[model samples]
Target: MKSMAPTRKLYQEIKDIVLLSDHRSSMAFEVSDEVLSTYVPVAVYWIFSGIYGLLGYLEGCRLHPKGAEEEENVASKLQVLRGVLLQQVVQIAVVTLMMKVVGDEGMAPQQPSFLVCACQFLIAMVVLDLWQYFGHRYMHVNKFLYKHIHSKHHALVVPYAWGSLYNHPLEGLLLDTIGGSLAFLLSPA
Candidate 1:
């Protein structure tokens, strides 16, 4: 008979213990705690991204000299900064919301026979990409609406992550609302 590897033995022991344990309810809590621990750093990074983006936008606005071309360039840089921050914020918010709403013991789906989580996640990426592309294109095509609604965003042409959030209320709402709605609609139940 071949000897079992240490890791394999350890895993078997753990599996046996879990099978014998009567504290099944606590298992869910443990899993949830582990998940939270893993994601906490990601959340922190997202907050930092927002802060840095804002700082970059401010710096660009202050340092760039006064001239139409210079101002436009600075604005463009700020917008890029803002875009980075915005993307991080949106990603974090969606993950946080999903965990909060669907991560409870009772909410977890039945155990799958095969690993499908990766596939589902990929689908989510596709949906988000499509939605963002369409939303941006829509903003560019409507000049009147773009001037009033999206012009403030253009003010930071020099985009940084921080500049990402410095947009008109309507633009903000439109982007967030559309993003959130599409994410929710496309998510696998």
Candidate 2:
């Protein structure tokens, strides 16, 4: 142990310098992949949205320069976000239901090479976009859906990145959740 101490110190130093890491982690990957996968997307989505929101703030809201009444913007965004979150909960429930009903055979493990995985992801992205685009178009054309299911998304006269996700629960679910899940389902193997 004593003989290896110097080598360990050198390795730590290299990690700190070359990797730009100053802290050492005593923890391991103790969480199950399923647990991680379930929560990571929500966490990542909010975080990325926050960063983009911050950038928009810093850049003087160039993306959507129009200003709304403070109460209207805040309350509208809050209400929409609440509904969006609820839709995420429902999506999770739906996925759980499907898993129980259909079984896990569809998600059989894969040992694909990087190239194959990349190709699958590219195709999945295309499918996701198509689904969302068609769904969104449908919502716009349907008068009832436009008034009830998608009007919230159009509340903002002009939308910044932060406002991109401000929408009715059903609209968000139809476009974001379904599109994303379709992509995952298509490439899950």
Q: Which candidate should be chosen as best, given TM-score against the real structure?
A: 2
What is candidate 2's lDDT per residue for 1-189, written digit by digit as tens?
358888888788666665655364333224534555567877877788788767766547455444543424534556656765786687676665645664555554657889888988998989998998899899989999998877777776544444556677767677887787778778755
Which regions in candidate 1 have their CA more than 4 angstroms from the true location?
Answer: 1-107, 111-115
Candidate 2 TM-score versus the reference: 0.67
Model 1, 8-98: lDDT tens digits are 8677667756775543432332545436643675566558766764564464644444343344654555445555456556656666666
lDDT of 2 at 158: 44
Alpha carbon deviation, residue 15, candidate 1 (Å) = 17
Q: Give me candidate 1's TM-score against the actual structure.
A: 0.49
How many clashes in each candidate? 28, 0
Q: Model 1 scores what on Cα lDDT?
A: 0.60
How accurate locally is residue 92 in candidate 2, as Cα lDDT from 0 to 100?
Answer: 70
